[model samples]
Every structure is written in structure tokens, then in C-alpha cells.
Target: MAESIPSDSPAVADDHHGHEEPSFWSKYVFSTDHKMIAMQYMFTGMAMAVIGGFMAYAFRMQLAFPGIEVPGFGIVTPANYNALVTNHGAIMIFWVAMPVLIAAFGNYLIPLMCGCDDMVFPKLNRLSYQIFLLSAVVLLSSFFVEGGGFGGAWTAYPPLSAKAEYSLTPLGSSIWLGAVALEFVAFLLGGINFITTAMNSRAPGMKLYDIPIVIWMIVIASILFLVSVGPLIAGAIMLLFDQQLGTAFFDPARGGDPVLWQHLFWFFGHPEVYVVLLPALGITAEIITVFARKKLFGYKTVLHTTIATGVLSFTVWAHHQFISGVDPRMAHVFTLTTLLISVPIAEMMFVYIATLYGGSIRLTTPMLWGLSFIAEFLIGGVTGIFLGASGADIYFHDTYFVLAHFHYTFFPIAIIGTFAGLTFWFPKMFGRMMNDRLGKIHFWGTIIPFNFIFIPLFVLGMGGQHRRIFDYSYFPELSMPWMQDIRVLATSSLLIMLGFQVVFFYNFIVSLRSGEKASKNPWKSNTLEWTADSPPPHGNWKELPTVYRGPYEYSVPGRDEDYWPQDQPN
Candidate 1:
């Protein structure tokens, strides 16, 4: 400032940077850098995952060995059991996996891949992370309060979530309402930043066609969030008012219909699955194309399928509420919408499988995760069709079968997809290759144990076991002995799944310092990020790249190399 250094000079950099590292508060606490914000989201999300996972482990201990004392955690009473179930679902689905997968990855990768200096509004991006953190803190804080966290389940269906008298603690329900509302606001701002940056901040000459599928999936998902989140936000406010101000928004006793909450919640909830799944699917698409040494088969088809799925997501909300006592006539329409939506999803999977055919496949860690996603998501999607059938749902609704179907879908999209993204982008994220041996071990450990955990849930569901019940002692007709056996296997599988993460964590942390140095284009794929520096600098590209090919132009018949970068000139 004394000499008025040029703004674009390397020494001068941007507005904030000068002779010294910005003050500790500006640098670490309120930083606007997308990368730092991403780290914030990642660490926060991981902490929440641990909390949520422990909750699941606690609940499973009870399920596997009923009346068992949970070591340092103490006994699992019924009220405590309900609290665990509700908070576990809320934290894992909303606060943990969703933020990590969508917000964290999306924030970190979108700017770098698109070749932008930073998000359009970097401060807003930072604010989003802070809001998410605040929401998590508020949510967790409720547990220590007088009434405990909300016990109405993640769905927060009325009469259950609405009335303080119905809940164990009078304030539990309101605390939950406040926490979810804050979380929604966090996502909304994050979504806005994503959409704005993607649409406006691409590197010079970078076209839509050249954009990575992962970014596309995120963009589409962001749009879905923007459109879908509003109704749920409105619903949450109404539910909160019903609890505090004695309004009848969702309170039947006060003239509000309890069923209204189900409609609003599922409206956002169903598409929310795709909102999480699309990014994972996009990761699968990117990893598969890079490792197969082949262009994505039917790239346009896959794009259309993603867009179609986003639109179709809004129409199928009622499928989740079929058993909530909605009108029977509307149920048929919902069932049709739910079952039919699977068509596009199935088509996308077909494209992935078709892409793998006759390709020179490199069985790297990312590819393993991609292949696992195909197998797991197929099982999840197909089983979802089973639940989509109104007839089957009438019997299976709220049963362990439904639980299994969702876990298959959820775990694959969440765990497998995240793993794929981590492996595929590890080089760029850390400037080094993850330990291949450790990675392979982690992959195998996750897939095998994951199957064991959820498949038994399906078996239990089909055997007529209901969900949310703390004890199965009374249900003697439901193959109690087999349920016991399944519970043991499931618990064992979960412990294994949880243990494998240690290997992943070790590999990730150690590799940052000791792993092999990654080449700029280690995977030999034709994406823009691969054309840039590994662990790209503050300003992504030294020179902005110009695009001339589709994202997956691998193994073209006459190409000199097996792959072509999207930015390479024809």
C-alpha cells in the first residue's frame, strides 16, 4: 500500500494479501478462500459423522443384545433409545453425509475444476460453512438441555413433534425445529453460491460440454436444492409455530392436519436423496471414464438422465408418505411416480455398465469404488422398486425391509461415492497419491461389511419386523431366533465397517506427507483439472484453458494418445 503495488503482480496478489499473512482472525477464523471453507466443512462434517455413527452403534448395541449396557455410555432406556434414533437420523442424513458429500466436495472441487480463482462470492461461501457449524452446535446442544433433542424422528411428523406433552421434554421439539431451520438456511446459501459460480465463473472458453460431470451433477443438485428446499423451510416454520404459538399448522387437535407435515417433509425429503446421490453418481461417472481409458458412453444420455431425475424428484414425494394415511386415490399416482422415476436412474446405471464393456480397465482405488457403486446402487435402486409398489409397501412400510432398501441406496451413494471422489481426486487435493495397498484394503473392507449390514436388514424387514421399536421380545411370530442371528451379524458387520475407516484415515493423513508425488495428469484422463497443476494454486490455472472436446473423450479410434484432455485443441 505504501508503494501502491500493482494488483495483478505475483507479490501483491489480491486485496487481502500484502507483506504479511493476514491477521490470525482474518486468515483462519473468517477466511474467504474456497479451499479453507471446504476444509472447515469437511472437518465439521467428519465430527458430526463420528457423533452420528456412535449414535448408530449405540442403537445397534441395543438391537443386537437387548438390555445390554453400553460400556462407558451406560444403559439404553426407552426414552433414551427414542432420542438416539431421532438424533441419529437427523445428524447422519442432514448434518454429516449431506454436508460432507455435497457441500464440502462441491465447494472444494467446483471452483478448481471450473478454473475459477474462487467462488463468485467467497465471503458468502465462508458464511455458509459457519452457519452449518452453528446449526450442528445448536442441534447437539439440545441433548444436554432440559427436554433433550427432538424425539419426533427426522421426519418430525406432527402430533409427535408438535406437542410438548407428547414428547419426553417440553423444549425438545422446539430445539429440533430451530436446528433444522438453521441447517436449511446454511444449505440454501451454499446452493446459491454453487449455482452462481458454476454459471458465471468458468475459465475462458470452457463450455458446458467441457464441464466435468461431477460439477454438472452438483449444479443440477444445487438447482434442485434451491427449488425443493423452500417448501420444507416453510413447513419447518409452521411446525415451529404450531409448537410454540399454539398455531394449528400441523396440529390436528388445533384444526391443523398431522398428515400435512408428512406431505411437506417428504416433498423435500425424496428429492433430497437425489440431491445427495447425484454428486456421488457424478463421481462414479468421472472415475469410471478416467480409469476405463474410454470416453463416457452416452454422455448426453447420462446428462439428460440427471436432469430428468432432478425434475422427476419433486413428483414422487408422496411415496414416502404412503403409509402416513394419505388418501388412497393419491397413493396410486404417487406409487406410479415413484416406480417410474427408477427408469431414468436405471438408464444411468446402464450407461455406466455399458461404458465398462470392452474397455481397458485399470483397477485403481477409484475404479474399485466406481464398480462397487454400480453393484450397490443397482441393488439399492431395484429394491426401491419393491418398496414403490403400493401393495408391497402396505406390508413392508416402516419395516426393516424399507430400512434395508434405503441403507443400500444411502450407503452406496454416500460412502462409496465419497470414497470414489476421495480416491479420484486425492492426487489433486493432496498433491500426492494415496497408499494404493491401504486404499484397496479399505475399499474391500467397506463393500463386504456394508453388504452384510444392510442385507440382513432386508431379511428382517421381509420377516415382518418393524422399525423404531426398541425391543422385539413380544414379536415371537417373526422368527425371533433368526432376527437375533441377523442382529449379531449386522452388528459385527457394522463394527468392521467402522474399523476400516481407520485405514482410510491413516492412508489419507500419511499420504499427504509420504505418498508418491502425483503427476499433473496421473490418471491420464482428459479433464481440465488434470491439465492444470496438481493441488492447484490460489489461482487455478497459470493460463486459462480452452476446451475443444467432450469431458470423456477416451480411446478415440485415431487419437495418438489413449485420452484427450477436454481443453486440448483439436
Candidate 2:
């Protein structure tokens, strides 16, 4: 049904054909252009990633050396160590991962992939990023306030987080909570825009299955966030009241239940894993299919399994509470659910492998990252099985094993997945191709050292290294030379991994200014975004595209082209 547009059609007309040129401030700063807003979120997230990385470097130095003066951080006081670890966790998950994966990608890709010019509520999209920026500023400001930032860990459990005397950061604790609350609000607005636009703004004739996998994944993630965030917001409000208004919502001495916070926190926290994860999984799906030159192995199956994963995510939150005084019977139920949730996830992984099977594969940088995600996340998933067992969890909880497992999963999701999506899309976002040699160099530099870092921690975790202690040397059981050596190895590898990020930044800047110019379909991708101009114009298309087939129609028989774009008619 698709037809080539006539020259006079608005879809083919230049974006500025009839409109005034936007002022610099409106175009760059307060722009309602979804692409510009995406740029804002991307740059802000990159800045936060740098801050989070420094926090990791500072604390890891303290862990590996136990009192050596760390460069750029001075001596790591116990309080400073705690603050660094807490804020690092908070910033990476909240400011860096969520904003980059959801807000940045969702805003840029949703309308384009769904074959629309812009979001249904463009102003709401801009407001979302503004609020998110404010939230980041608020969180950073907390460190300079009285008593430094909150040190009760990222979870902010009660008694410690509720009572300022116990937490020793009366002002910081409240400010941290406020910052998180504001972030949730920003995403709430953004989520609505994502869902509404994808639902209502698709080009004519684009059906549900016609939607790209990434669009579906982003929408699912947004829905999951909207549904799961309510309880956490309520819990944060109560915690804030406890910190400032003398409320005892979590104070056991005041007839409050401290455990209530855990339930509320994990309820959101566990699903939040998938909230960020689904999009990464979606990113991999898109990349693997294009590079493999194959149709997705089973499109609907992947979709249904993703839904299954999201549903199962809610039931397994209590696995985290196995050692928190949960009843044995309750723990048994949660353990079953935790292990059960792995089925759909593992199925999804197998699906990716199957998609890659027997296809002509290109080992491009994005493909390498996509491939690495499947391999590394498998290790994270397998190790998580031991921790999911209630009996084993009793020994492993709060240990370095848990820490290593957490990073194996998160690093793949946040860092590797971001790189995959970014490199794959760079040509489209800017009218240029990234240096593949530099990209692969950064990839190997990051991946090899990454394993060295976490594998040592996994071993130390089995050797019973607790995660919370700032100085293991004081505890004779943990101070064994071998254990200390492993800590130093992990920290050293972390430095290597962090050092290679310089290659990525260098490549990014050089590519923007001087890389080879990109053709519209550089990767021969079939998605709607590819049909538009590279660095698509303000309105995206000279004329909007009309969908004629699904997004992954590679290698259709009797056609000279190996790929068929969504907007191309037979």
C-alpha cells in the first residue's frame, strides 16, 4: 500500500520550507525537538557517568589499599568511603542508566521507529528532561551540605536512614530522598509521553506487530516503570517525613515496621532491574538481526517472553529478603519465584543465540557488544541461581560475591548495552560513521580488563569477603594476604577498564567533527529511522514514511537487495 511521495507532499518538503528558523536558545536549550532533547539527556548522562566512575575509582582504591592516600581523593575516611559507595550506586542507576537508556533513547527512537514526526506531547518531553536535570543538581548539592551525603547505602533502610543521629547526615539524607523523588516524577512524565506517542502516533497502516522490537521494548519498560514506581514513591515520602518531620513510619521504637521499607523498596527495585534491562535486550535484538542479515528468529515469541519476564519480575522481589528475617515458608515461595523468573530470561538469551545461528555475521563493534552482553549476562544469571536459593543466600548475602554478580549484570546492561546502541545509532544521530577500529580497540580494552576485575571479586566472595566493610585489614578473617591480593587485582583491573573509556570519548569527538559522511542507510537497516536522512532534519522526514512491511525484512527471496525498508513498497 505504500507509494512514493510526490514532490509537493509535506513529507518530502524541507522542514524549514515554510517556517521561521528557530533561535539558538530555543533550538539548543529549550528545544521541543525530540532529537535535541535526546541530545540533552545523552550528554547529561555521560557527565553523570564520569562522576559515578570517579566515585568508583575513589572507593575501590580505598578497598584495595585500605588507607593509602588515593590520588584525586586524598585519604578515604570511613565516612567518605561510605558516601562514595552510596552515591556511586545512586548516581549510576538513577542518573546515568535510567536517563541514558530510557529518556534519551526513548525520546529519539520512539517517534522515528514508530514512523511519526514527533511525540504526541512534545512539551511534556522537554519538561521531563528539565526536571531530571534539576534532580541531578539536587543530588550533587547534597554532598556539599552539612555532614556530607547520606551513608546508609543506596537502599536507605530505616533506623539508619530515618534517624539523623544514626545516619549523621540529617540534611543530606532528606536531600537525597528529595532528589530521588524528583527523578521519579521526571520519568513519570516522560513515560506517559513514550506510551502515548507509540500508542497513538504511528504512521497509517502500521499495526502492532509492525512496530520495531526496540519500540516495543521501550514501551514495555515505560509501562513497567509506571506500574512499579508508585510504591517506591510512597515509601520515599514516608522516609523523608521520618528524616525531617519526626515521623516514625519506619522507626521500630515508635511502633513502626522497619521491614515495610524493604518490601516497598524491593518491590520497585527488583523490577527496576528489568525496567532498565528490557531496553538493552531490545537494543541487542535490533543489532543482531541487522548484522546477521536475518529476520528475527521468532518475533512474537520474543515479545511474549518479554511480557512474561516483566510479570515474573514483580513476584520475585522478596528473594532479596531471604536473610532479612522473612519467614521460612515465605522465603521458600520467593525462592521458587526467583528461580522461576530465570526461565523466561534464559529463553530470551537462547533466542538471541538462535537469531545469530547460521547467519552471515558482521563482527562490528556494536555486534561485539551485543554478543558480549549475551555471554557475560549468562554468567551473571548463572551465579544468581546460587544466591536465589534461600539456603545459599544465607551465606552469600552482603558479600563480595553479591557485589560481583551485581556488576556482571549491571555492567553488561548499562555500559556495554549503551555502547552497543550508541555506536549502532551514531551514524543516524549524526551524519557520520564512527571509527570501527577505534571502537573495537575500546571494546577489547574494556571487555578483557572487565573480566579480570570481576572474576577476582567472585573468588573473594566465595572466600567470604563482606561487602560493607571499608577496611578488611582490621578484620583478621578477611585480612589474609590472598584475599587482599584479590582485592588489589580487582581494583587494578577497574583502573584499566576506566582508562580505556578515554578511547571511546576520543573516538566520539573525532567522529562528530571529521569522520566519513554517512549515507542514509549506512548499515542497510530496515527500520523507519534508517529511511530518513542521517542526522534527520528537525521534522525527521522530508515526507513522512509509510510502512509497507515489518522492520526486519532482510533477505527476502527474488529481491536484489538483501534488506527491505519498512517504508518501501513492493
Candidate 3:
């Protein structure tokens, strides 16, 4: 059972012993180490999240109190409002969600959990972050450019996005497209790295079934992104050419169908939801199983369901096009596929619940987050059924209902899932336990206001309030006092949610500096990562672990301990 495992290279050994300590630049900034790179991606993504949140604040303030000078930001102009909405969507999805859920956690956890010292291609991993960083820089720089940022929205639908005259930001539009394209390329690289490393590198005896769910989820997500992103990248290039060169790929007057871009975008776009979502779901799975002190119910079922979800994701992209005048038969096909895709997701959620049943459940902050993900995301899933049906979507299309459904879904995937993962792994990542008291405070603060924020949007959407309206005063029907009152409620709820994030940040900083010192295996779980140091070193372990059992070996009969470590020999 104690077979020899691969050790770090001589160069790594020399750096630790024979050579001097690494400088700040080499150690933290441009390091080829996967963990450092993950830190870089995580922090960068967090910073972008703050920017995205501020954008939400700015735009929501405008919606709640039109023409009023917002604090921190003065009067929000029409262009400013559009840019805020557009970039907020783009940054949160691409910059924040993908980076944190996939790149950051994927990079950090894959190698460590897999019991390898580093990624298969460490330099390539570093290069991926560099490209991602450059893409972010390019995106932010667009806002300060000659025409301000692109206001064509995150989807960048054609006619508006393809034509400079319509978008009013020739340079900004092109730069935005370019930034998005570059970001895809970076992920393409990172995805390849994740897939290859997970496939190739594992400790001895760690069979396919023995691998952690988080690793599988990240790898599967990488595959989904790889398959789906190509068409959008091509469409982005074509859109760029239309904007800069004399092309009409998406211009109706020039014989190019604008809806063609919709096909290319949503084809990737719908699956993009699952791409981020799979990782978040995987994170919740880890948290739930650990805190509940139970074996994951139907682990293989979850795996198979995830794969089915990915396959079905491609078929459902056309649902977003139902209201775009797509062929009714095609819409019907997509509608069926859209509803079908939800089955696997719902199955995974049920599997989690089954795991929690009759188990010793701990109400830790991370567990609360994990449980809330299931609850909140269930709302998103159920609401999505309305949008999935072509007939219902025809009424709900482009309304605040769609917006509310989207937020309900994505808020869980990106924000709630992220917090769940962060809190669960805080000790492993930082070698210190986060303050549970503060964590619970922050959790309730965020969750309560969150429901308040979007539930009203669903109501407003049902009332036929258009999502894109800068101000509703012009429309007498929408300007009704009740409608405006709902808008204010949503916006005020957002402010409270944003305000509570302060508690999280304070808790994070204070805990990082001086928190309770944590020992290895703080969670006492079965995953291989727990066998290593609290904050594992350059070569994760003095000797790499050889797996002996599956990850979730809890409550095995005849043993005093309820939990079993994967590497422990009987």
C-alpha cells in the first residue's frame, strides 16, 4: 500500500534547499507554481467581482431613482447606464464566475487533490493566467477609451454590436470583442491544461472512481467550454470584421442575418451556464458530504448525470432564440431539450439531499451556503421552465421575469457557490479557520437581501416591465406607483446585500492575519488533499500519498472513526 510516488524535480528541491528564497515577483507574481497561479486568478477574480458589484449598484440606483445623483457616482447618463449593465454582466460571468469557479479553484484543487506536486504543464498554466490578465486589462481599458465602453450589452447582438454607427463606440466595441475573444483563448489554454493534468496525473491506486468530484466537475466543465466556445470565437471575429472591415456577416441590409450571431452566441452561451455551474455544483457536493458526515448518495449517478447535462446543454441553446423568430418546429425541439437538460441538474440536487438525510448534519457556514445553493437554484430552475417553453417565453421574453430567472440561476452558480467553496476550503487554502460567527452573519446578511432583490424582479417581470428600460416614467403603465415601488425594493435590497459583503471582507482579512491555527485534515474528510499540509508546500507532500479507498468513506462498520482517509492503509 505504501508504494513510492513521484517526487518534485531536482530544480524544485534546489530552490527549497540549495538556492536562496524566491523574491516577491518570482514567488507570487510570475510564479510557475499552480497554487500561486490559482491565488493570482482568485484574487484577480475577486477584484473584478467588486467592480461588477459596483456596476450593479450604479445601474440599480438609476433604476430605483431615475435622474438622481447616486452616491460615489454622480448622475448616471444613458450611455453610462448601458455600459454599466453591459460590463457588469460580462465581467461577472466571464471575469468573475469563470475565473473563480473554474480557473482559480480548478488550478489549486486539481493538482493538490489529485496528489500530484504540480500541473502537467506548469509554464502553460502560468501563461494562461497571463493571457487572462491581459484580457482583463484590455476589457477595463475599453471603458476609458475614446467612446467609453461598449453599450451593446453582454450578448453583443449584431446590428448594435456589428455596426459602429449603432453602437456609438467603434473602438470600445472592437476592444470589447477583442477582450472577450482573448479571454476565450485563455480559458481554452487553461481548460486544456486542466483536462490533461487530471487525466494523466494521479497518485498510485487513485482510480477513476477514487478521484474527487470537484476534479471531475472541473474537468467536465473544461470539456464543455472547449466544445462550445469555438463557434462564439468565430462569431466574435466575424462581428469584429463587420465592425472594422467592410463585412456584413450580421447586417440585415447587407444580406447577412442578424439572428445568425444569436445562433453562434447562444449555442455557446447556454452551455456556458452549465460550464460554470458544474464546478459550483461539485463544490456544494464536497461541502455537503463533509459537513453531513455521510457518503455521497449516488456518486456515480451524479457523474453520469453531469455528463448527460453537458451533452444536453448543446441541444438547448436554441430556446434563447425562440422569441427571435426561429422556426416553430426548431423552437419546439429546443424547448424539449431545455427542459430535458434540467433533469440531470435536478437529479444532482436530489442526490445531495439524499446524502444529507439521516446523517449528522452540521450547520456550518459552508453547509448553509451549500444548502442555500440547492434551494435558491431550485427557484432558478423552476422559473427557467417558463422561459424554456416557446409560448410562455413569447410573453416573458426581454421582460424583467427573464432577468429575474437569470439572476436566480447565476447568483447561485457564481456567487453562492463561490462563497460555499471559499468558506469550506478557507482552512486548507490559508491554513487558518474563518470565524464561524462572522461567516454566519455574512451568510444571512447576503441570503436574505438576495431573495428580496430578485423576487420583486420576478413580480415586476410578470407585470410586463421591460428589462432594458433606463427609466419607466415615460411609459405610463410601467410608471404606476406599485411598479416603481417594486423597483425601489429590489434596488434597496441590492444595496443591503452589497453592504453585507463588507462583513465577509473584514472577516477574511482579520482571519488571514490572525485566526485560529488549523492542522492538516481539519475537515477530517477522505479526499487526498487533506493528507497533505494545511497549506501544502511547493512539493505538496514530503512523500506523495497512495490512495487506498474512494473519497467518501464515512461510517464504515466496525471502525471507531466515522470518517476514513483515502490514503490510510488498513
Candidate 4:
């Protein structure tokens, strides 16, 4: 057998020397153990996902039934509806997706995958999760405050988000800003840990190439976030001052430029898209190659293109500002950059396709989600080109088209990518196999309903139905009977999608206790995490693993087994 991760490796031995078993609270609640902390991130993100999903259901009901009473929540007032919209976007991206995708998996997998015992800054890692949890609680608490959650949308644009009078939220706006500022701080701290650990803590033989694609992508994402998020942090502070202290940094009435905030926000905002996206792509990459039983085609090419994509993301933020009255020349420049950014992304897609061609494909549950991500993300990416052209954006901006574009992009990134990673890593994380049959059922239910909900928005958007309103009853031309039909269909599909997740959640909970116990190398792959115990040990390995080859070394000629592990001493 080609076994690799030792149960008694020297490095693990050295690190755990004189290590004591943690008490229950220390182990589960406040431990510096990366694995335990990962569970914390996962559980918290899942909780927030429920909150964000309910907000979506609330607004979708409003859209479909038009002033119909939402069941748990009363009739969605215009402000309440807007609050749902704003908080849904903000919570999913900041609280749910960022933590699940970046913090949860990044902390869990990076140390193990990089052959390190723990993050370089273990205390800081715990602090990041603490801050992240606090951010979530603070934002959720905004719902009960004097005015209700801030309705200014996630962007928190200047004029509306500037003054509570326009927004109708005295305390909500500042609380929202405070919550988001805390989120930025958490990610900044976590990003430092991710980058430092990857650079300095790899095992002796694990070269840059030997590092798995997922770890590399996470490191790149951390760097991208660190560089891109600074201006937004500063901008958020200015917005805070403008809101509470009446400083008017973004208030045009007080000699502040509203457009300046847009510039600062989108500058970070654009890169922020890829900060989550690169990890999604990376997770999908790992799953695809593993299930297909093939070496990742163009691994180095994907890496270089990822770097190129990060660089290009900075230049394209103005695409979101087309209607903000940017000069025509700058619009032209942004349009070109926006379109150019797709090339690298498209090239990476080609690499994924090439990786699967002529290989034995598995189509497992994780594979299903990975494949869905490629197909759906492509649809989302392609539709974005129309909006990227500044001329077309004049027509499409803020319409259902833009809403559709983002949901297609981010829904796949946030939902599908997370689903794929969750399914892929379930065995390693929990020491058991999730129900594959149930997993496939969840996959179909999710992807089909997902497409049904958003695909029609392209039609509605091109037809010129605007987004973010409580009702379109007055827009007779736009609110045709067919419009209601599609709205009903989309809303119904969303409900169906939510229903499917019930299966996943049930399976997840039950399987944790009773699922088939997994072996150390369940999928029989080469990654170091697999070489550890199925759920891994406190320190991940008994001794640090010495990597002998690249991550994804599968199907060498004359090899008896189909998979070639990196630590396999041939």
C-alpha cells in the first residue's frame, strides 16, 4: 500500500511533546486548535446562512405576491423589504460566505495541507473567529434596534447611508457600519495568518509547486484582500464619521464627494469579489481533479492566471460605477479592463475542462457541485460582459439584469462552491462519509432550482424591470401578468431550493453520528490531509510529512493503482 502520513512522524512528535488534552470548553469553545476553530467557523456561518435565507424568502414573497403577508414576518413594509434586501446581501457575503469559504476552510485546510501543525499566529486566529462571531451578532442585533436593520443596501452608499433621515434608521445605519467594520478587521487579521503560514511553514520537501492549488489560491486571496481592503476600511471609517459626527466625508451637501465613496468602496469591492471567488475556484479545482482521477491540467497555468486575475480585478471596479457619472474616457478604460479580466478567468475554465477530458470522471456528489459551478459560473460570467460594456450598462445597471448577474456569479460562488467543498471534505472533517445518495439528491435539487430562479431574471432585466422596490404594481408596462408569472416561478424555485437543503442539513447532522466511518484515505488521493487520521489528530500529523512530488500525481503509466499520493515513496 502507498501510505504516506505517518501516525508517529517526528515533526508531529516534536510539536505535541508534553501537550495536554484540552478540557471541553477549551477544546470546543475557545481552543487554539485549528480543527476545532474550523468547526466554530462552519457552525456560525451555517447559522447566519439560515438568517440570510429567511431574509431572501421574505423579499421573494413580497415580489411574487405583491403586498402579500409573509408567514413568520408580517407584510413586508417597503422599508422592511429594503432592509431584507440590504441585509441579505451583506450577511451572506460578509458573515456567511467569507467565513465559510475563507476563514473556515482556510484555517482548517491550510495548516494541514501546508504540513504545519497550526497557524503561525494561533492566538490571532482565535481572535479572528471571535471578532467574526461578534460581527455577526452585532449585525443580527440591528434587526431589533429602534429603527430596524439599515435599508441602505450592502454598498452603504453615501447620501442615503450618510443620514438616518433619508434611510429612516437612526441607530441601524451606524450599527451596520460598525458591524461591517468589525468584519473587515476580522478578515484582515485572518488574512495575515493565512499568508504567513503558507510562506514560512511548509514541510521540508513541500516546494511552492508542491503546495496544493487550494492553499496557493487561499494565500493569493489573502494577499489580494490585504492590499484591496485598506481603502475600504478607511472609507468605512469616514462613512462612520459622516453618519454619527456629521463630518460629511461622503456628503455632497457638506462639501464631501459621494462619488469618492463609490470609488473607494468599489476599489475594494471589485477585488473582494475575487477574494471569495479565487477560493471557490480553488475548491472546485481540487474536487474536479480528485474525482476525475487525473492530474490537474495546466496547474502552473491556473496559478499564473489566478495572479493575473487578481491584478486585473483592481482595474475593473469602475465598471460598477458606470452610472455614477464617471468621465466617458475613464468608462472606456474600465470597460476594456472589465472585459480583459474575463480572459484569465476563461483561460482557467479551459484548464478545468481540459483536466476532465479523456479522464475517468467520478460524478460524485462533490463532483456534481464542482461541475455545476463551472457551468453556472460560466453562464454568470458570460452575461456580465453585456454589463461590462459601459454603453450597455447605461441600460442594464440597477435593473433585474444586474441582480441576476450577481446572483448567478455569487450564488454559485457562495452556495455551489461551499457545497462542493463541504461534500469533498466531509470525510476528512468528520471521520465519516456523508450519504452519497442524499448528497446527489441535494445537488440536483439545488442546481435546478437555482437556475430556475435566476435564469428568467435575464429576460426580466432586459425587459427593464428595476430591482430594490417593494412593488412594481404602478409600473404597468413592466408589471405585465407574465412578469408576475415569472416572479411566482422564481420565488417558488427558491423555496424548492431551500427545501432541498433540508435533506443536506439532516444528512449532515445524522451522518456526523452514524455515517459510514471513513478510512484514513477514503478517496485514495495524494493530499497530506488525507494521510492524517480520517478526522486527523490534534496536530494533523504524528511527524511532519515530507512531500516527494506534486499534489495531483495520478495515473502514471505502469502504476498499479490509479492514484499517486505526494508522499508515496516509490
Q: Could you tell me the lDDT of residue 19 within candidate 2?
A: 40
Scored against the true structure, residue 461 in model 1 reaches a CA lDDT of: 89
Over 1-570, each residue of candidate 1 has an lDDT whose tens digit, in order, gives 112544444222233433355688876678877777877887788788888888888889888988889865678888888889999888878897779888988988887778776777665677788888899989998888897767667888878888888886678778878988999888988998898788877877778777888999999998888898888998998988888888888766667788887878888998899899999999999898889887788878999999999989999988887777778888899888888798899899999999988799999999999999999988889899888988888899989998899888888877788789878888987789999999999999989999999998898988889888887886777646877999889999998999898999899889989999999989997877787788876556767676676778888898789987777777
**Residue 156 Cα positional deviation in candidate 3, in Å, after optimal superposition:** 0.4
- The list of candidate 3 runs beyond 4 A from truth reads 1-20
- After TM-score superposition, the amount by which residue 146's alpha carbon in candidate 2 deviates from its true location, in angstroms, is 1.0
Q: If both were scored by lDDT, which would come out higher, candidate 2 or candidate 4?
A: 2
TM-scores for candidates 1 onward, in order: 0.95, 0.96, 0.96, 0.97
In terms of lDDT, model 1 sits at: 0.84
lDDT per model vs. reference? 0.84, 0.91, 0.90, 0.89
In angstroms, how far off is 358's CA in candidate 1?
2.3
Model 2 residue 382 CA deviation in Å: 1.0
Candidate 2 lDDT over 1-570, as tens digits, reads 123544344223112322468889988998878899998999999999999999999999998998999999899998898899999999999998899999999999998898778776676778899999999999999999999998889999998999989999989999999999999999999999899889888987788999998889999999999999999999999999898899989999889999999999999999999989988899999999999998998999899999999899989999999889867789999889999989998998888999987788999999999999999999999999989999899999999899999899999989988999999999999999999999999999999999999999989889888887899878898899988888899899999999999999999999999999999989999999998889998888878888988888898889999999888888
Clashes of 1: 2
- Give the per-residue lDDT of model 3 (tens digit) for 1-570: 112333354211112221247888888887878888998999999999999999999999999999999999899998998889999999999999999999999999998888888887676788789999999999999999998999988999989988778889989999999999999999998998899889887888999999889999999999999999999999998998999997999999979999999999998998999999999999999998999999999889999999999899988898888878778789878878888887998898889889988789999999999999999999998999999988899899999999999999999999999999999888988999999999999999999999999999999999988876788899999999998899899999999999999999999999999999989988878898888888888768888889899898888888999899999997
| Pairs in steric clash, model 1 | 401-461, 526-565
Model 4: how far is 371 from its true place, Å?
A: 0.8
TM-score of 2: 0.96
